[model samples]
Target: MKRVQDWLLRFRWQKLLLVWGVFLLIAAVLFAERSGVQYTHTRFRLSYLPQEQAISKAQALQEQPATCLLLCDTRQSGVDNARELFTQLLQDMKVAADVVDLAEVSVNDLPAPENYQTAVVLMPNVEPLGEELLRLMNWVEDGGGLLFGMSPSNDRYFTVVSAKLGVLSTSGEYKQAESIVPAEGFMLGGGQRYELSDPFDSSLAVALREDTEVYAATGDEKVPLIWGRRQGRGRIVVDNIGIYDKVMRGFYAASYSLLQDAVAYPVINSAVFYLDDFPSPVPGGDGTYIRRDYGLSISDFYSQVWWPDLTQLAERYGIHYTGVMIENYEDDTLSAPERQTDTEQFRYFGGLLLRQGGEIGYHGYNHQPLCLPDTDYGDAYAYNQWPNADAITAAMDELIAFQKAVLPYAVGSVYVPPSNILSAAGREILGTRVPGIRTIASTYFEDGSGLPYVQEFDVAPDGIVEQPRIVSGGMVGDSYMRLAAVSELNMHYVSTHFMHPDDLLDEDRGAAEGWEVYKGGLVDYLNWLEKAAPHLRKQTGTECSGAVERFAALTVTTTGTNDAWELTLGNFHDEAWLLFRANDGVPGTVTGGQLTLLTGNLYLLKAEQPTVQILRQEG
Candidate 1:
């Protein structure tokens, strides 16, 4: 009996040993796949097809009835701003405009006022136009739309047309407007007041008639910022918000739509959410917050706690992330680029992101900013500049190779500058050597001088697309929301936001509020965005760059009749998106495009061909 019991015990011990062996083998296999040191390279390539203009200049400017006249005075101080506003905002709307400089054309021999549906005056002091200004005003009284691009000047000429402008009286003093409060439905995501950080005397101190409809006003005292009134058979829309910049383009764009019966403009129609320094080395941050809440280390908290929550949030909101990889947290600028071998974290996170319809782009070989040695980072950033261009090239080359080895199927087209500080030399190197880098995502708004490289949504002269992020961070504020709303109306823009994984570690970035509170703030903004603009397309960073490329390459000309509107696109791509506003007609049917109703009378049109025609019943 003792011998039989010993045999059974020995058999049970062997069985347990076999089980442990199997577990060890499985762990080894997983470690091999997740670690870069044991990588098995594959031949999957991701490419970026840069868009180019497909139509000639003559074909672009097709014969169309001029719907608007953009009048500017070269002698005026704000003329350049007016022209830029017209070019960047109004021209892209497909509204055919006859731009005439007052300095070039004699006031006596001005173009006929009967040829236009609306006239935009850019001159601050219209006294120089003599009696010619009256011709434009008479046209307005006779069923023509008129828009004053700037606030009314206290000159005698403007006082003569005070009644036409809906002004009952003027204090002849500029009123400081610290906040902009748009009425509900005046613009997308309206009703929230935006307080200006740098308030100035921007709005004119004027009272309006009872019939005048105020669209926006100053907070607190409720002074009118923008208002419109009916004059005779036509209408007059006054843009009293005197601010002019890329940030203010949307306000003016929305105000311009008030003049036309129906208007349409091309749009990118994509919203991209970028993750900077994601899937990199565990950031250096205090784990006190993590321990207090989840009882986990900073590394464990990121993987076990933070990631699950963030991933759930993205899934809930249908947000696909575009994570820019930072190979290492080392600030190495002088040494040769080194490959990261312990890439288990990157493999785990990056795989999940890609599987969930996300993308992986380049952040940097290290945390150092991509500036030359001489570049001054100022006090805004503490990043070290690269020693030389060769060092940058070597680092970037290694990063590209490493990403290709790890993520062979993912596209490396989008590149976000580390710390938003890329010097001119760094930019040149990127444009020339880094052919795979098709887009540079930078900041859209400047916080301070020498802080960040501000960019616009346009193709650079170097053929690389510049798609700047409008707002960032998890703690979304009213100013950021307001900016997002304005840009949407003006450019048919979708928001580009960026966030870091280590935000919870930094006290200034709401770490003390804890993950629950910080995440709640982010969720609130996402909910607001979903409710406000549900039709915005959620795309990865590269996809957004492609959309911007198409928008920048295309030129459109619009022609309108009593019952139909036709748009001819110049650089027709495979697909294009546009926003069409129908004020006096119900859009019936569309050819070469499909229409989706957005809000109020606004419709989103997706065009697949060069020509798009909308048939509508005349209202």
Candidate 2:
């Protein structure tokens, strides 16, 4: 028995050592496989659309008999602003609404109400119209659509038409609406409050009738922001919210949609997602969040935990991320930067991104903004400016060279500025020096500090397309979601969202909430966005630029009768997308296009030809 025990003890250590070595080998194999140890060189290219030499601007209000008339009084401040707002809105919607300047005509020259199916009155007062206003009211009762395009004046003139506008009573004074609360199912991302920035007295304090449907209102008191009511056989929509800015454009567009039986317009129909500062350098963020939640360092947390979550999200939603590479986080502005030699991390992350049907974009060689020394970053961001144009160009060239050396892919066509900051000199460099870059993605709206670069979705004079990021961060706030929803309606359904790898490290971006909570907020936002716009085609940065190109080049001329509407598209490319709304009729047939039902009364149409015909049955 003593000999047996002695033999067992000696072999036990050997067996245990053998078991530990086998486990280590298995773990190493898994780590290699999961981390993409074997990098695959991928050739990436921008999917630019066929360009047209010259695209004509769509002429607003053709000589053909108009279907809608807009009464604009250039004398009144509200009317002037409303005209500017509605003119662009109608032009985008392809609605043949003729503008009739009240200053150019007398009360006797007012057109008969029977001449148009719908009318928008932008005048603060109707005293100049005299008895002619009664003719329009009678026309509304006899099956015409009317929209009070601006907040009505508090006078006897508006009081007389108040009944037709669904106003049961009014305090006759303007009220300050603190927040915009859209009703459930009223807009894309409804059932939420979008707080106003320093709200003013822009809406009237009016009580609506019981039967009047309120689409939007003030958050606290529920004062009608936008409401609609039926008078006899006609419908009337009142846009009580008087604020007019770029942000309010979509809200007003939606309110105008309620004035018609049907409305159809072209949309970009693309959604792009961007990852800033990805696959470049490991961000130095506070490790408390990672340590507390995952017991891992920030660097290890990104590889093992954060990246896995993002990749899983992409897989679940079939999202293709455009990762903008930042070669290093060093602020090396004066010197000509050398090509980065440590290519393992870049290869690993870039390879993983490409394998998932993603694309790489140019951010910067370093974390510095591309502004000249004269430019100031202000208090919001502390970024060093470039010494001169030569320095900026040298850094950019080094960035391009490093990207080329690491990956077999062509230089990316999209360039996103660091911290969304770029100066006139920097832009000139990109336009002239960086010939491969075709698009610049920056912030859409200003953050008021004048630090972030602000842009509109349009082709710049230098021929570079501007595809601005509309929303950002994992903790998508109410205001950001509101902007997303509004842009979807006005910008023809294009959404640009950007995020960063180091968002987990910053407390301002909800890092202290831990990965689960931080990631949950992003997931919830994605879920809401998916539910709101399932039809939005997921595109990468270059693909989105391609979509913007097509949308910009095409001009739509709408002509229709009572039962049919024909759209003739100019500069028609290989394909075109449009949003057609059937408000008063059922779509009977669509020719020269394929129709996909998106939601109630909305159909996404893919036009194959320049001329698309739509036939509808009377509702």
Candidate 3:
């Protein structure tokens, strides 16, 4: 006390002012809290920030209605990384949202419940309490749709939301299962048993309360896995499907279907097809179908068998298949047959396809990535072949030169890596090499396995893009899986499907089988494609690259709804129309990237950066 008095007395005015400032800060905080001001902080960006045109058309579309709020309370426990991933998944799901961290908003400044039709709470560790709880209750009661995920802390929310919304109540216990089969439904699972990551917390069998609407259920016919009910003016959907294991097992499409179908979200134009293992047939296979030697050289097979079938399919379906070009299938000693016919027959075939609205994409040199002949990330794994950077670069250059040789000016910037495997180093070779490649053709989901590379599509620090192919011509009978894959792909505004004419031949799925044997699977899938997602526009690999390049250059902002959506794309690509997944409804007119829906989510000729608007007819 004496020291304080002495100090205050010596620097009396300055010390007094400092003390007053501190006192005022504390007092103001206390007063604001007591006075019921809604305290708000912006939710940190959670999704991968896509590179878009600096001048976005979204500026005009800003005030457009929102479909959902990606809810993440920054103050919550265990929300740092998981929340960001969840946000990314939502963005990947193509759901437009305002990432709202309610903790940051003052109650007075909160937007009306009507502003957003749906409120999504995914894997939030902290249950909304106190004033936040009250605000949530008000929003739901006043007609806001609620979509929530399962977590330990979900009980508090479930109890409150269930009671108010008149939905089912649960103790928040996960029904244990090692493998559970889903009935034929669009939401989750298949008739075949699904492998669970956590056997103990596989799925939840929620007991439905009165007035609950059940759309899907488990095999037992007793427990409800998915159910929903109307609450006041809002709707509540309960998705008790657990994704922990599915995500681990790489069944990304199933997980998406469950979450999205639970709400019956509008799905349009979201698929791309790339037919791999074509033109270049690799030798020495698994003995099921990969023969010891040639039935015919790739050029003859493509010219005689695949081309006509593909061209017919394209004519019938209004689609162009992307046939990957492999310059060399074997060693120079073994490639004599390939060389003899390649220049004459192969280029002619390639040129014919290009003229027929087909696309040509690079596979690899001698069916190998830029790597030493023996460096093995795995058999057919091109991404991790080389032990060092120099080896990888050398191999990359060889491949680039090979493409230049094969197609000359016709070579596409899209590189469908051998076996859909790529390492960060291999990607670097694409970005850093002179006359480097632009887009990558592989699944968006990649696992780097704790290496220097990131398991993803987009190469970091450089602008190498990845256009992921979501569907392949496998499991020709699994219509629902195809549906899930296409819808999910559409969510990202990119559709990719790959098939090999070989697969149509052998007992194997992706083998280079003859056209006569392969046509059945193709026919079934194409018919299903027409029936299921006919609205999605199909583009050749070249067009897909053009669209990606165009989209990358454009500023994109989206206004979305359950039935319709509008993407205002700025800085459009010249002669580059972006194909969008939209419904077979009113495709609003536009200048750039004009909209068209084939049936469910297919279309063609989306001019680059088209400000397309989709209008859903109110049923």
Candidate 4:
């Protein structure tokens, strides 16, 4: 019995030691987590804007249906704070928002399609479901908006989401002082003091004070916290502060205000949905050529009746012309002799055009829409035939070969669809399949694609001048004159073409008594433009093409919503100064080299070679 007792005592002692080791291991893990965590101190209150007033103002706005999706892991304390804050925000803005717990719903069980127009996702400590979150980002890209908040513990997920949304989040921890006092220049509510003890820093705290500011600070090093970006038709507000701290919870007033503002801003601003690329000179001077349809089919009057007179008039007015060659088929049947004769005439005309400092771009193989399936061409002779991919390829090959044969004098060879009627497949063939063809005329799709907002501009039937297509041509007149002369203007670096010289010549004659009057008017307009808008620079189709290619190659550094932006124009040249307006204000100069801008409205910038660096400004 004594031996049994001794063995039992030894087992108890061993069990006690094991428990102590387990306790130490847990303690170590907790200590590591605490040490690595970031903390934010909320000691500063906005000097010019009080939290209550901001919230009150936001609440007074007409309410809209919006949801704040809180995706928190119930097991983490960080998520608990997020839940509490979300609950309070909903309670405060009951009319404007609803807080939805994503954890409660299955992936397939998202709210009905139209129940909400916006969402704020709180991903505090949970491991981000990468692919799933990526899919959700698609909603914002499609016009639905989102707001994201995360902690340093989830840096991997934060980075993935940031990249997809065109933003970047830092890796280290940041801290706000234990308390803060407003500075003299503070724009928000008058001098006020506050206390803070949150684990994560509120890097975006300054943004909450006004509609027009962005504030950020890096980790403990205090590398001026910079963390805010506009993302795909929506705004994303990021704070490095820990989600679980009481100090952060105390700022619920400001946080809720921000949430309310994000939801309401889009509705109140009509211009948010209307964005466009500022018109600037095409990067290179090569985009100035013209596109024309019809080679030899036009009656000999083209040269004998129109060329001599038009050439003389253009020379007198210091204007040049570039003729685009098109195969005009009055009837499908043409004897070999007639075909050869017509081809020769085209070559002769092309030579004349080049000698006169003009260019000749392709106007489709036979002045037809190049679509797949010959059956789709129907009975219209103008439709020609693009039976299949092979047929289209063959046609383009023949046309290019013919043009090359006429070489040396062809001078700047490019192709322009007869009536802007090429299919996607045709575009692919021109852009990729065809080799040695340096450039393709800008198409409608190129101009309108991916614009943040809907806008109306002039569009010509042929891919020529980018003009506003007002219904009444007589209202603006046939010259395509602009209505208002603002300091800034958007000029598309595109080649413009007009039909047979006879049409333009006739219009000129009808508008004036003779060629001299026409010449005088043209010269006067050019002179006035140069004097009034000396920055206007001419670009050729090739230059425009190169610029576009370069633009395509650039990597987008950031993205976000909010119409206001601050862009950096680095190392620009004297000749490349661009004109722009801030926040829809009057036009201002955008000198090249290093420049900064802040504005809400869209403006035009003119430059020969310009690089754009964008930052979102809250106001």
What's the count of clashing pairs in each model shown?
0, 0, 51, 51
Per-residue lDDT of candidate 4, residues 1-619 (tens digit): 9998788677857788778999999998665333322212211111111112222212332243344454444554466676665554443233245544545655455554235555656665334444556656666556554545544343566556645433434434445543332221211211223333332354422212223233323323333222334456444444444433322322332222232222111000000000011000111111111112222223443445445665674565333443445444322222221222235445555555444444455654555556654334333334544656766666666656555555343534345554445566676666566654544442322222231111112111222222111111111122223211110121221112233332223343332233234435444544443343333333333333333222212211112234423333222222123223232123233232223221123223433344443333433
- The local distance difference test score of each candidate is 0.78, 0.77, 0.50, 0.37
TM-score of each: 0.87, 0.83, 0.63, 0.37
lDDT of 2 by residue, 233-338 (tens): 7889988888766667677777776765666666777778899997886788687878988898777888898878889999888788999999998876777787
RMSD of each: 4.9, 6.6, 26.7, 33.3
Which regions in candidate 3 have their CA more than 4 angstroms from the true location?
1-85, 93-119, 124-131, 143-145, 151-157, 169-201, 207-235, 244-271, 281-303, 330-342, 371-398, 404-409, 446-461, 476-490, 501-519, 549-619
Among all candidates shown, the one with the greatest TM-score: 1
Q: Which stretches of candidate 4 lie over 4 Å from their true place?
A: 1-300, 312-320, 327-344, 374-382, 409-413, 442-497, 502-534, 550-578, 582-619
The residue ranges of model 1 lying beyond 4 angstroms of the native Cα positions read 1-68, 73-83, 91-117, 141-144, 230-234
lDDT of 3: 0.50
Residue 75 in model 3: shift from native, Å? 12
> What stretches of model 2 exceed 4 Å from their correct place?
1-46, 53-146, 181-186, 191-197, 209-213, 229-236, 486-491, 617-619
lDDT of 3 by residue, 26-143 (tens): 9987554333232222111111223443222223234444566766566755444445555545443334567766577654555555576666665444355445555766777676
When sorted by TM-score, best at the front, the candidate numbers are 1, 2, 3, 4
**How accurate locally is residue 91 in candidate 4, as Cα lDDT from 0 to 100?**
34
Regarding TM-score, does 1 or 2 come out ahead?
1
Q: Estimate the TM-score for candidate 3.
A: 0.63
